[model samples]
Target: MFKVGYFYTDCLVPMVGNNPYATTEDSAAELSINAEVYSLPSRKLVVLQLRSIFIKYKSKPFCEKLLSWVKSSNCARVIVLSSSHSYHCNDLQLCSCPFRYLLTPSMPKNVQNKIKSLNWKEMEKSQCIPGIEDSEFCVRIPGGGITKVLYKESSSREIPMMVLLKFVSEGDNIPDALSLVEYLNEWLQIIKPSVNDSTLSALPWKIPSSWKLLFGSGLPPALF
Candidate 1:
């Protein structure tokens, strides 16, 4: 969805390694060490894509800075696409849909009502201490990386934000990604389905060429 745009360098920083050369085979001539931003002015959308994992201790600071930037940019709202470990889901979670959503308290009531109309499930609070029936419940996302932190920060800062995530296992997450996008489309209506096709399955989506070798190039024939 965020294939084309000029580089947004304001928030760019060397948060990861300092290697000047591209470390992976799929990357272009230069390395990707900073978060990238893509703007779709026609649609008034700005996508901030984090290319690398944040250093463990820098997660909170990064989220704080990101929220500050959002406020300064005067963006109407923020939507985060994330995932969680399917294996970590509780019994109730496993029985229902794998998709879930969260909205900051400051989100507009109309938007909240819209989500409700879609009949989406909210991220469930898990036991703070596992195996203890009476343990306090708290929001936990085992493999969600910075999702929880970012959500909490956005809530406390009163920045209208929404989180859409899915329960997925490791490996081949392309289908999961497509499903999440479809879920988001139900609310954003970024792409409208045909009148004959009420479902999003027929929506025209162009996958970027860069995704060709997503997992990596094929092994050399010489190796065989």
Candidate 2:
């Protein structure tokens, strides 16, 4: 399993329990935690949440103690949560030190491609369309499967676990949403699969009234 580290402030702890993905100490995670931030729904929520956890009890020793935690922690990636007030895109960025990575779900290939087609860049320096940014946490695999976890490094110990996010393009093609259901359906074949059954049951989300107006009663997506 990937070791994901999340640091949020104590103030937001109460609110996180409401998140469908909110993790807890009892989970089989590498670690579950609590943190502090200035307030809820921050202007710079994600970073502020990290800051909150960094100086939870006091603000005096912020930099020094955080650096120590970074050096000692065995986490591979960081997951930062933004306050409800955030209105920007769904993405994550890592700082320059510690050879670290940031994992933000929904940063899928389709989203990236759509962003690029519109000539938007993920960061300020590069246009989203022109660059292929680095991300170790989520890797893409061809032929419609995702390699989620490669547990061990050695050749003999290595294990490959595949996850299908959604389906693909054009003529005689599978509908994206329906294909996603099938993709997830394949997970049943794996030994101790990562996905739980509840998610599968939520196969199709009820389309909002606004979305119905946009897509004309939920038409299946055709590949471009």
Candidate 3:
């Protein structure tokens, strides 16, 4: 099961496209929850989208409740797809790759093993303070927006959660989203493996119609 973000997760839901074998709608009056549920029986996948504008105070409680629901629903694990500010990339992280992941301490052993088998690079352990010897190395996301909170909450509750993200900056982010999906597919295989990078890149991915206006009609004709 996945609770993908509408924007920061690289617009993953739209990339998943629409229509499934079954569907449902769920909301909570007390929590300002509005979501559309999609079920793909053949793939045994369920997606819950909570894409409304975020208010910090409201989102804190909302995430708490959502985690509780996930626990009750017997979800095997949670994978959060998000991005980090490219500027936050450190020298070590920059040298290795733009991608990194964090696994909650309580993730299943088998799950942990599988991730290892893939030879994926885990986020680097870096100095908490540049010159403080006793300071601990910790994970930080300067502009990750709610991702840090969700990871902390899930970790505290012992929920098996994994976050996969890239270091990126604002632009025509459609390409970023596509690149992100390709990264995710390396693990999930939501789309079948292809013969080559070119073939793999050609896999049909549908972007939301809303994106037609992503660039906002361009440069106003560059009036001189």
Model 1 per-residue lDDT tens digits across residues 81-145: 99999999888999999999999999999999999999999998888898999999988887998
Which residue runs does candidate 2 get wrong by more than 4 Å?
1-60, 84-224
Ten contiguous residues with the weakest lDDT in model 3: 21-30
Listed per candidate, the RMSD to the true structure in angstroms reads 4.7, 17.7, 7.3
Tens-digit lDDT string for candidate 3 (149-189): 88999999999999888888887777778887787777778
Quick one: ranking by lDDT, best first?
A: 1, 3, 2
Which of 2 and 3 is the better model by lDDT? 3
TM-score against native, each model: 0.83, 0.21, 0.75
Compared with the true structure, the alpha-carbon lDDT of candidate 2 equals 0.30
Q: What is the lDDT, from 0 to 100, of the residue 174 in candidate 3?
A: 79
Q: Write the per-residue lDDT of candidate 2 for residues 70-173, one digit (tens) a residue.
A: 34643222222111111222344223111111123423456335434544222212233434556233332223211112111111222111122321333332
Best of the candidates, lDDT: 1
Name the top TM-score candidate.
1
Return whichever of 1 and 3 wins on TM-score. 1
Model 2 misses residue 91 by how many Å?
A: 18
Ranking by TM-score: 1, 3, 2
Where model 1 places Cα greater than 4 Å from the true spot, the runs are 1-33, 197-200, 219-224
Q: CA shift at 73, candidate 1, in angstroms?
A: 1.5
* lDDT of model 3 at position 5: 32
